[model samples]
Target: MPELDSSSMTNPGSKRSNNEDCFLSLPAQDLWMVADGMGGHDAGEVASAIVRDTLAKYPDLPLSESIQRAHQAILDAAANGIGAEGMGSTIVALKHHGENFEIAWVGDSRAYQFTPELGLQALTTDHSYVQMLLESGAINSIDAESHPDKNIITQCLGSQEMETVRVDSLTRPWQPEQWLLLCSDGLTDELSHAEISAILQRYRTPDQATRELVKAALNAGGRDNITVQVIAAPSQPKPSMRAALAHWVPIFTHSRRLDAIIYTLALLVLFALLYWTIF
Candidate 1:
């Protein structure tokens, strides 16, 4: 299995006095998650904490099932008066299995994939009123960004109206040197996709990328709790000497670069002579 490198950060932001955001990083289990809570007082904090703690306890569970369990747990807490009546949270969870990974999410806490080839790609869609408007052609991407209802999510965990949460999920083949980012809306609200892509491209390491992302968001006016988790696949290993020779032989033979062709021919001739002498 390819090795994984990961980093995570959470902050209350410039306007918020308390953070209602939470994240979980279990590299041993190849699982990571971020939750953004909603409600008044400390209820939002309780809602998001329940999501993080529950998923942390059951790291091996399927992403959707675990989130469902979290939904019930949150509802149970509210019923028992653990939090306010309308407390809830948005969640995005990712898990890796060998060369493949699965991601599941609810509400607007987003999952994104970044690669050198593709830059930054959103892995999960937002479950929000603004997203609906954009999809229906009632609003454009620019309008959605500044929409007054942009923060109004359509569904989330711990909603009194939803007995069974609707979890959106997808599985994809993992690639070397790729990054998976899970973050709350606070980060997205502050930074545009272009800004985020530039930051990721600038910082190759997961730790530096997460730190710079949070900093940029704060600089852009952090109006809500911000949380981010960045996971990177191991860099592809360099080819062995024999493998290098095998790869170059074909390319060099077809190349117009005289020095490269001569170098490859000399290496081949040396190997052939050595083989005959040994035999």
Candidate 2:
């Protein structure tokens, strides 16, 4: 199994005094997640926290099953008056089994894949009103970006109207050096896909990429709680012994002693070739 390097960051943004977004990165368990909460007061924070805690507590469960449980957990919390009524959250979760990976999500929080070849590709489609409009050709991409109802989600966890949350999922082979990005809409709302792709291309490591992305979002006007998780497949293995030797050959040749030895070997090879031709 290829090793995975993961990093995560969450910020309250410039306009928000409190952050209602939460994330989890468990490389050991091959799990990662991001949750964006919604509600009045601190209920959003409570809802997001429940999502994080519930998913963390049930690492052994399947990704879809675990997310369903998280939904039920939030509903239970609201029923018991643990949080304000109507508090809910959007979520995106990822898990890997060797080279194969799965991503499950709800609401508008998103999952994306990045590679040198593909640049940035969205893995999960948004469950937002704007998305519905785009699918129905009622609006174009540019119109959706500034749509008044862009933030209105069609489904999410802990909805009083929903008995069971509808979870969307996808499975794919995770290639080496590819990056998996899970983030709340706060990041997307502030940064365009092209802008995000540029940042990821600029930063080579997950930690650097996550930090820069958050900074860019803030610079672009952070309107909501921003959360991001970047997971990268293991880098290519070290070069072979022959390649390593070739890499050092020029440096070694700069030494007079090694230069003399190399010259001697070349002469000996030439002489052996001549001798073999004569024989």
Candidate 3:
């Protein structure tokens, strides 16, 4: 199996801990996640950390299952009343499947697939007002920067009942030197795709790429919390066995529904099969 190398960084910006942003990289499973929180006081940080902590607990799930369970975990955390009401966060998660990968996201945090041929293309669209305006042709991409409602996000985890998040999965036979980039609004707001691509090309290591990306945003006047994670697949084997194993470890002792509806459903299906055989 190919091993992934990753690096991440987060900064609070001018505000205190209220606006929390964080990233996690599971090298063994080649999974990476970035979360950006929004809420008054320190609630945002609390919410973001809670989501990350919940996901970090399970590192070894099959990529698709892992992504779904991560979202469910975040929703469960919100429902359990960990923080003040109205607290929510945006997330972008990427998992490697052999030479392929899958992604899941909510709110404005984003994922980017980078290759020398295709350059850098954003994989996730922000659930923000300005994006809607841009899509509607009421405004252009450049105009979105100064739009009055630029910061308004329409969807986020823990904000309402039965929230819908965007989940997308893409896979390609692993290439010699492919990279995956995930980050929050902080980097995109201050830098363009070309700028980001240029920096990535220059930085040899994922750690340096993350650091320089944050430093560039900070130099441009970091007005918000910044979080970034980059994972690059190396052709040779690497040390990610522990993380891969952790991800596969079941987070729950047993499926609560198994003893309830699941068992009943199994019996019903079995009965139908026996009836078909007899009849």
Candidate 4:
């Protein structure tokens, strides 16, 4: 199996006094996360910290389950009166397993995938009122991005209703040599998809890409807390003849052709057995 290369950066942005965002990067575990804390005062920071700590605590768990644990922790903290008034946080996480990836998130924080062939595509949907309106045809995408309610997220951790708490998720085969980007809404609010795609295309390494992304977002206004994470799958390696055979042999064996042949043989045997009994 191949390994993943990852890099991350976080900033308070131009207007904020302190950064309330938190991130987790565990390349060995092939897990990465970003959380944007909400609520005034330091409560936001506390919520974000709890999200990060809880999400990273169990590397062995699935990404969805990890987020569930994180959400519960925030709920617990809120009950204890630890700067938890109206406190909640948005989270986006990606876990690489074998040749597939697991993605889970809440609120407006998002994940994106970029490849030279496909350009840039969003992997997760924003859980905000604007998103809801856009989906309902109440507002166009251009209007939604700049809407007043764009920042008002519909779901996140620390909410009183735990039963309704759920993380949106997606799983797909990992595209090798592709770039995976995750960030808080601060970066997206400031930069457009084309701008982010350009920066990702220009930079070769995850560190360079993530740095330039945050820098560009700050230069564009930086109204909120910003955090960026980038992960790249290892480049494809040339396979030897033996390795190639090992990879494709199983696929061929279980393909539609083999199934058709087996079905045909079974039908023929049944026909012959019936003919012998009748004779």
> What TM-score goes with each of the models?
0.88, 0.86, 0.75, 0.84
Tens digits of per-residue lDDT for model 1, 160-237: 999999999999998877999999999999999999999999997999999999999999999888999999976677
Q: What clash pairs does model 4 have?
A: none
Of 1 and 3, the candidate ahead on lDDT is 1
- Model 2: residues >4 Å from true position, as ranges? 1-3, 238-279
Instruction: Report clash pairs, candidate 2.
Output: none
Q: Of the pair 2 and 3, which is ahead by TM-score?
A: 2
Which number leads on TM-score?
1
> Which lDDT tens digits does candidate 3 get at residues 61-133?
6544544555566567656876666777877888777756777777788888777777787877888888888
Off by over 4 Å in 4: 241-279
| Per-residue alpha-carbon lDDT of candidate 2 for residues 117-165, written as tens digits (9 for 90 to 100) | 7799999999988999999999999999899999999999999898898
How high is the lDDT of residue 97 in model 2?
78
- List model 4 lDDT by residue over 9-41, tens digit each: 999999989888989998888889999998877
Q: Candidate 1: misplaced stretches above 4 Å?
A: 1-3, 248-279
Ranked candidates (lDDT, high to low): 1, 2, 4, 3
| Candidate that would win on lDDT | 1
CA shift of 44, model 4, Å: 0.5
